[model samples]
Target: MFFADGLNCSNFDRAVFQELVDGGLGCVTVCLGFWEDAVASMDALGRFRDLVRANKDLVAIARTGAEIEAIAGSGRCALVIGYQNTAVLNGNIRFPELFADMGLRVLQLTYNNQNEFGGSCYEPQDSGISRFGREMIPELNRCGILIDLSHVGERTSLDVVELSEHPVAITHANPATLVPHLRNKSDTLIRALAARRGVIGLATYANICGEYGASPSKWADMVAWTVDLAGIGHVAIGTDHGRNVGMPDLTWMRQGNWSRIINYGAGNAARPGKVAEPGWIDTMKSFGAIATALAARGFSQDETALLMGGNWLRLYTEVFGETDAQKQLAA
Candidate 1:
């Protein structure tokens, strides 16, 4: 089965990643940086590119679904470079094109706080997609970059669904109905996203998953519930796996220097807490357990395949269409 993680923040461990691919991972979207300015974003992109190049034998930068399929066929993993915020664009409309040229594909409009584009879920008030955000949508569409609303405010997420010409994704989130967390999504928003043929990725973060450390059964139940709500085709896997490296840990994701106080994402507002990786599917190698879990829940092989990766492949193929720059870069 081809597995695509919605978010992968794991510390670079080539041997471990290779082992995971050998076990059963196809593609993973790794964030370059969020809350970064243009220059820093480019720098991060360069480093990521270098990492891919260094491990070219085991992985390749996947800019298209065909490439992903081909790479998986070769028993290697495909890396899709994604960004968690548009701060890299720096309000410059031209940056999306530049990022696309640099092999950046998925881009979340905002993180957990307000930016030039819109409000974040953490904000007391959601301003929704701003004028500049409205302008960026078309350009992002044209550049063949997939729009993600994983960390956006509720209103902003809805606004994106209404405004985007192409289907947008909440690439890594759980249903709030089950967990009742801010990071999780409501049924209305999930349905709205599905109506436009957009996909919703089931998040693996414990807080969003409604437990400090969830079991495979719990995750499977959530996936089944999501499929029931959004249709089988609209559900996919986006494990928000964080890099376990203490040297460069998740401090950037939570704090980002956006706030003097630690902004514990998915954790409660009172204090920060670490998201202990679930025992069953902690690493990418264990991703196949999800398929087994689905099977146990009476999901057919086709349905299991869809949840594993086919749905994501369909969404990416459609959203990240063949633009001139993409074609040229491929050549």
Candidate 2:
């Protein structure tokens, strides 16, 4: 099976690329722009393009399933550039098309805070997707960008699924039924996503996993539980793994520039630092353990393959349209 990570938070560096290759990862979606404005976000995308160009032998940018398969076939990791927040749009409706042209494939509507698009799970009130957000959905679909609802509020996420012409994704979250974390989705939301043929990438972020963080076996149990809720076709892996990340990065990710005071994020005052990673799945190299655990939990090879990456590939094809490779096959 082709191994693809729905969300990996590691910075784009040669070492990180090498680790991805070494870990047998065929494709990975890496967040490039989060809270940056237009200019900064453009710079981030430019730098990402330059990095991929410089490491052509190691990785390639993939916007479609065919590209991902081709790049992986050539022994290079396919990198899918994603944004954790739509701040790069800066209220301009045309920015989705512009960013799509520039190779931004996956975009989350909101981060941990409320934005013009919609409310976030962390927000006290989820006012749902705004009119601007309503306008942006069709634009995103027209541009072939996947709408990700990993950090979006329940109402906003449901609103997106209902509004979008193409199926969306919860790129990195788990089942609220299993963990009850704010970042995890409720069974209703999961069922709603699956009803629209959207996929939910189960996350292994320790805080969100709660007691399941103890081991890979426990994590697989949570995966099984989610599969029962959303079905195997709508489940995948999105380890929110960040290599070499420290407190400063965590603080920035959680607080961004929205708050003057530090937000501990998923962690609280008692444990006010980087959330501890599960020892068994701590690094990029350790990702394959998920497959092993799934197999042990009675998931068949085909089901495990879907959970590993196949499900995400199907969603990518459905939302991003056909590439030259797919067109040829169709011919």
Candidate 3:
């Protein structure tokens, strides 16, 4: 079975795109905008669409499971447009439908800071989902947008999972039981997420992995433990991998416009930059190595398929609905 990467923060550079294509990914969710206002977000989406048009042979945009399957079947990468933050909404509820019409499929409720929607993991006190967030959740559900809570606070994440009609995602994080990082999810949250049939994409990002370090074997152990806790169906990969990322990009992701000084997110004064990715799975091309690692860890082909991409396809089908072709087939 083909696989999907739930979240890839890469700049979508041609070289990066080439690696994804070569890596044998059936589908990938790329970050289209984060911390951008509505206008700027639209512009970014336009540029991304242009990029797909320019490289039509290598990639195609997909908004549903059937489309993703068809694109991958044709030997092209299926790109799912997503946002790391809902800043693009600009406090307007109507924007969800607007972006969804434009082919957006995944929307993260909050990034590293609290916003109109809800509280963030970085916040000292999490107030849970705001009134606007409660209103926004249903709109997002009606529009078929997959809600994401990867960087949200505990109270807020639980609140969203409870309130959202459809299952949500913690698109790229590890278990805090293993790492104890604020960015990682706790046992309670993971169980709650799994109980609701949500998926938590296991991250290969180093800081959250903590002592797990760079070993593919260790990474597989992390995946195994998650499966043991959340069941095999609820775990998947969201590598958070990027290509040619620099300090400026890191600064922008961590600080945005909210902080005058460097926020040093997932970093400190001694190491104030992008955390080193596990060497084995550092780039898109190396992503397949994760499959081999899982196999070595005694996961069956069927189980590995679910972890690699089958589970994500199932989730996408649930939230985005099947395409006309699928409907016709069922009919």
Clashes of each: 3, 0, 0
Per residue, candidate 1 scores C-alpha lDDT tens digits across 1-331 of 6777767767666775685586588888888887789999999888877877888888888888888888888888888889899888888999899889888899999997898999898889999889998999999999889999999999999999999999989888899888887788999999999999999989787767776237777789889889999999999988887645452356677778666776567776553556667888767778888889889988999899999988898999898887575679999
Task: Indicate the TM-score of model 1.
Answer: 0.94
Q: Which pairs clash (backbone N, Cα, C closer than 3 Å) in model 1?
A: 6-238, 9-243, 10-243
lDDT of 2 by residue, 1-331 (tens): 7898999998778988998888889999999867899899999889888988999999999988788889999999999989999898998999888888788899999999999999999999999999999899999998889999999999999999999989999999888887887888989899999999999998888878888878889989999888888899999988888887888888788888878997877788988887767889777777788889999999999999999999989998788886435569989
Tens digits of per-residue lDDT for model 3 on 1-331? 6979999988886777788889999999999877999999999999999999988888999989889999999988899989999998999999998898889999999999999989999999999999999999999999889999999999999999999999999999999999888899999999999989899998888877876656888899999999999999999998877678789998889988878986877777988877777778777888788899999999999999999999999999899985435569999
Give the candidates in order of lDDT, highest first.
3, 2, 1
Worst 10 residues of 2 by lDDT: 318-327
Global CA lDDT computed for model 2: 0.89
In lDDT terms, which candidate is top? Answer: 3
lDDT of 1 at 190: 96
In candidate 2, how many Å is residue 31 off? Answer: 0.3
Q: lDDT of all predictions, in order shown?
A: 0.84, 0.89, 0.90
For every candidate, C-alpha RMSD to the true structure in Å:
2.1, 2.1, 1.9
